[model samples]
Target chain A: MNPIPMEQSLMVAAMLFSLGLIGLLVRRNVIFMLISIEIMLNAAGLAFVVAGSHWQAADGQVMFLFIITMAAAEVAIGLALVLRLQSDLPTLDVDAMDQLKGGDDA
Target chain B: MFWLTSIVAIVATLLAISRLNATHALLYLIVSFLSVAVLFLQLGAPFVAAIEVIVYAGAIMVLFVFVIMLLNLGPHAVEGERQLLPPHAWIGPGLLAAVLLLELLMPLSNNQFIPTTGTAKHADHSTIPTIPTEAAPQLQERMVVGPKEVGIKLFSTYLLAVELAGFLLLAGLVGAFHIGREEPRTSAKPGAMEVPSQEGPA
Candidate 1:
């Protein structure tokens, strides 16, 4: 079987990244926003793997390992913030958490 | 095989993002991760494929599920999600993403964007013996990068990065603990004054 074209793999990654962007823009919930971020990170990892395969280098996978580590850390802190927000507020909607959106009148 | 798995991953991710219930979305996300693992395998990164399944699909997803359960999201949460996600809410982002996808695909389809190598070339000093050069060179043109190469390169070239990642994880652990800690009760009970009086006698 012929190897999958690099361009095709990259195209897949791009599509996934775009889907992630759409999710991030549309989702109001904090958890969903985190999920969208994960999708975007994964898409980036996929692109790295594709590039690594094209070069036959392990650097791409190594970069992917770092991305996963970062994702894990981000999720840990993000979920904790989610819990904190849940305790302080009644809703998880990002738009509703506008306490920091101060006005000059304050 | 690659195209099929890509389609599966894409569809699963779309469903994941669209689901109202968090758990349902997570399940689809797991499916998406698993299919992406298969894609990694097809790309000749077995170690990466394994890590994708173990770390991404297994450990990370379990963490997500645990948080969702701890949040105790109920049917009402789903109802709220539905109300928040009106049809018009999706239209703008969907159009933007569609335009992004079109732009991405157009350049990719162009002949000038194709890679010169077309496929991966095997390294001369490769440690893996599975490549049968005499039997079928054409079938195994792409190099199969295993764990050994990845480990060597990681420790030698990216040692500082690994250390930094560890530090980042430690920071994340501390930050999570601090942020998630329960606050002390602000209101004092009537018996609070009696406790100090009893301690003074003792």
Candidate 2:
């Protein structure tokens, strides 16, 4: 069996990032977009772990642990804000979020 | 081949996301995640493969299925709209698969194909052979850590991060509960009762 190389890890990470980016761009649902963002974060974490493994240091994994923490914090705050927005507008259509467009404030 | 499995996984994932019915979508998603876990296992990252199964296929999909059951959406959600749209959803995966096939076939550039070139100075001496395959079997064996090493690494070096991850997960549960708040509509009052739609706030 061939030992996995860092390049292969990078390729997997690239696939994940591309999929996530496409989802974020194409999907209309904010929740679905949030899931895509989580996927992207996971791709980054995987790359970090792979790099760390080659170096024989656990530092990269430690950093990924922190990255996961940040992602959790972000989604918590983000979803809360989304809840407030939904409560007021009662529509999750991100396009309508243009209400924050100059038209509403003006 | 591994490429075949990867392609299948990608196709499954794309189908999972694009399906109109929520339940079918979740089902396809489970297939996709499981296949990706297999890909990870083939990559020799058994640890990541386990996480992919446990965290994604097991926990996250359970959450999705729970939400689907809670919603109790009407049967055959796409029953009425049979005509207007062309069969476009199928095309998306076809196009993606084509691109993936191209990527799989393409050869790597110098940066990717270049060897690591380890064991330089000792390579000259007869002690270390130029070709690794010609070397001693004892030296060629890879180092593998048992569960003990993993435990030590997790608790000793990563204790703080592990504790923090637990706290983050707790907070996520609370946040999900709060954000996913549905009106406790135990009893429907009347016709004008406002049931929330997906169009509800961002």
Across B1-202, the per-residue lDDT of candidate 1 in tens digits comes to 5677788779878988998877667867887787787778677777778789899989889888877766664546667556655676555345434443453345345422122112223333343543334424533565667677888989999999999999999999999888776545423222221121111110
Candidate 1 Cα misplacement greater than 4 A, ranges? A101-106, B73-127, B130-139, B186-202
Per-chain TM-score of candidate 2, chain B: 0.54
Chain A TM-score across all models, in listed order: 0.93, 0.88
Question: In order, how many clashes per candidate?
Answer: 0, 6
TM-score of 1: 0.75
- Residue-pair clash count for candidate 2: 6
Q: Is the docking of candidate 1 incorrect, acceptable, medium or high quality?
A: acceptable
Model 1 Cα lDDT, one tens digit per residue, A25-97: 9999998998999999999999999999889899999999999999998998999888766654556788767
> What is the Å distance of residue B92 in model 2 from its true position?
14
lDDT values for all models: 0.73, 0.52
Candidate 2 docks with a DockQ of 0.21
Residue-level lDDT tens digits of model 2 in B68-187: 343332343254234213466445545544553443333222121111112222322322224344333422342211223334567788888789788887887787667555445423
The alpha-carbon RMSD over the true interface for every model, in angstroms, is: 9.6, 6.1
- Name model 2 segments beyond 4 Å from true: A56-92, A97-106, B1-5, B14-25, B72-147, B181-202
